[model samples]
Target chain A: MTDAHEIRHEIRIATGDDIVRIRRAVRTVACAARMSLVDRTKLVTAASELARNVIGHGGGGTVRIERLISPSGVSGVRMVFEDAGPGIPDVRLALTDGWSTGQGLGLGLPGARRLVDEFDLQTVVGEGTRVTVTKWTR
Target chain B: MDRVPILKAGDVLLVSIQTDLEDRTVMALREDLAERIVRTGARGVVIDITAVEIVDSFIGQMLAGIAAMSQLLDARTVVVGMRPAVAITLVELGLSLGGVQTALDLETGLRLLGAGPLDGGPSEAQDRR
Candidate 1:
């Protein structure tokens, strides 16, 4: 298990522009890692969804991108979004498709999970929310 | 905010999404497109997204919004040239885009809207590239 990490980028999500920036940053790293085109697209889309959620739902946050070497020597990219806002009170409901408390399609959380190889979520009712997603070139 | 340009081609309004779009920009484009359709009395609208890398749920909503708005304005909306990867991602993202009509390329999209005096075919899309 190699399991090495290198921070590639740290993007602040303040406005609509930051969402675009995060998508570009993720694509850059995914391409450099020689990820396939479909994998790259899925990863980038997942990041875009999460980034928007950080602003629209989390009330604003930041995303960090990292390069990874999986256990079997596979290259991958990982991103973590962190926000200190009104955290989600219902994790299960929040991840359910077509369920939302805001003016959104209610697909952001679940959609993001479907687009990546690994997904992680942590949130506290009064604290914050943290989301981690990873996509490998395999 | 960078605005995506909307060009009037005969009775159709053509919009090519050539860059990464901010959520606000997509919203603005919706308004801009509505105004153009009404001002030009366009019978149809063509949105070319071959250059756009991804269409998240928000952008998907934007396309659906534009189509719905155009429908009420008595105009048809056709989205064209979506990348294969983007298409797969959208499906996995659970956005059926049921309300939006799509074509494989700009030429096909124009045909779907019933071309008026817009004689140019694939060249129009190629010229933009």
Candidate 2:
């Protein structure tokens, strides 16, 4: 919200195969943004975790990827994952490590948050969930 | 889903993962490995992930699950060649991969399994090729 963003990609998160595709696409954008190897790996890992969530809990969703540019000219990447499935009942519990509403290890939401610089989550109990993560170049 | 090739070298069953794995692919690898272990009666399993770019919780669980399965089949498992960033992220994610051994690379993984003090019976994880 500080400066500007360029939309890069929109992907469907409906199958296991899409997990790989989502990671690859996020990786492409991250690399193009000149992120460090560690940064790229972190962002991609986070993307994969979220995509799996969309497939597992959300029952399918959409991922929107964008490139961020600050007023000072620094660059970054942002990924928004929106799911129309059952929204979380407790955001705090969902963020807790080792907790899960599904078969996963309960790391997806919390783990993804740590991998990026900015983390935002919005959800309505019956409506859906939207998770946006951003990683800015230092 | 692309299947990771499994090769046999002496008493060790080697698996070099070189692709972005989906959940189904990991499940397939697990089944394939379990069957291979029983079929060959291998003494050790070495999984090289040096080329792998990341290890989210799901993939981390797959690695642990494989090691556990191999242990049950009387084969020691060693995961090798993890990138530094992957290591950092896995730790941050709270997955220690409990009960699975790790090494710097293929040779070290093989050696660890060969001399591994874990449950698998003693044998040379020899490279016959």
Candidate 3:
């Protein structure tokens, strides 16, 4: 396995404009990983959704983009969105399709999960929420 | 404040989203489009998203809202030039774009809008790109 350390690029999600920056940053890393166009689009779209959630629900936070190398030498891109706002009380309910607490289509979380290969969510009602997703290069 | 350009072609209004969209920009687009439809009395609206590489749930909702608004304004809205990846993403997101009409390209969308009577029938144009 490669070293646990990888280069991480951080972006502050303060406003709507920052979401555009997050997408662009994810795209650059995805392209550098040599992911195909379809994969790139998928990753970028997923990142966009997560970033929007950060701004709209999470009240803005930070997004970290990292280059990951698996034990088998497979490379991928990992994005982590962290927000310090009202946390989701029920993670299961939030992940369910068509279940949204905000004025959204309720597709942000589940839809992002479908677009990525690895998905992880951590949240505490009063603390905050963090979502990490990865798309490996095929 | 970068606004998407809205062009008028004969009786149709063409809007091509060529840049990354912000939330506020999208809201402005909705308002601008509604105003243009009223001023031009356009019978058809063609939205070209070929330049856009991604359409998340937010954008998908925006498109659907625009289509519904156009329908209410007595204008047929046809969304064209969706990238293959974007289409796949939208479907995966479980967004059917409900009432929005789709076409493969601008030409087909315009032709479809022109050939049919407003509110007569659905366009026969294939949705592929």
Candidate 4:
């Protein structure tokens, strides 16, 4: 049959159009990897929320996607979004629900983190913000 | 954030959501929306969320609550023009609207509520039942 290398793909895109493109790209990548429907939906949702945060709060950012091969022979996906905007002044407050600076309930980051298996975030006031999320399937 | 009045045009009520819908504002909006649903006895309610860039867990919960109240009040509640990011965030947060209807845009939202755009002053909508 065919080689396993034929199944992998990656994506990199800007956070524009309020994160719609990012979600579509995520869905395409996840589907091609043959992820479960539940996992695919969750992954897409997580990507969408994170990308939106970069656009709305961070002003703009970049999104990167990668295919991961687990040590146990499982296949999964990882996505990272980076922004060099005003950055978060208070990361802890921003992560809390009902703590939105604007009209939302502050559920974006916390919600995104919950949907994926691995989540990491790093931000600096003047530097920028980076978020990494991963989902696994054996 | 400026609080808008409940827009009544016939039996349908239009509620506008701005970019600051957190905590107390969310609670207030819920109570206000419920009151309008009861007072107008409208057949349908359309919540325009075009201006909102995010829809966090607390707001999501309140929306679901509004939908339930709408059913009990004999009115249909439809959320319209939700940004893709907001939709994703809500789903990721394990927040489901359950009985509430969603539309891609305001036009569809109003249509789902059985209301058409009126050219003149304001349109009219009344409860069928």
**Candidate-wise lDDT, in order:** 0.91, 0.88, 0.89, 0.73
C-alpha RMSD of candidate 2: 4.8
lDDT tens per residue, model 1, B22-95: 88889999999999988999999999999998999999998999999999999999999999999999999999
- Candidate 3, B25: how far from true, in Å? 1.5
Q: Report how far residue A138 has shifted in candidate 2, in Å.
A: 1.5
**Regions of candidate 4 where Cα sits further than 4 Å from its true position:** A1-18, B1-42, B45-75, B78-129
True-contact fraction per candidate equals: 0.91, 0.76, 0.87, 0.28
Report, to 2 decimal places, the DockQ of model 3.
0.75
Residue B116 in model 1: lDDT: 30
Which parts of model 2 are misplaced by more than 4 Å?
Answer: A1-7, B115-129
Model 3 agreement with the true structure over A1-138: per-residue lDDT tens digits = 545335668999988889888889898989878899999999999999899889888998999999888888889999999999889999999999999988998999999999999999999987899999999999
Error of 4 at B123 (Å): 33
Per-chain TM-score, chain A, candidate 4: 0.85
lDDT tens digits, residues B94-122, model 3?
88897899999887788889843344465
The DockQ leader among the candidates is: 1
- At residue B37, give the lDDT of candidate 4: 79
Specify the highest-lDDT model's number: 1
TM-scores for candidates 1 onward, in order: 0.93, 0.92, 0.92, 0.57
lDDT of each residue in B77-101, candidate 4, tens digit only:
8989887666665666857666778
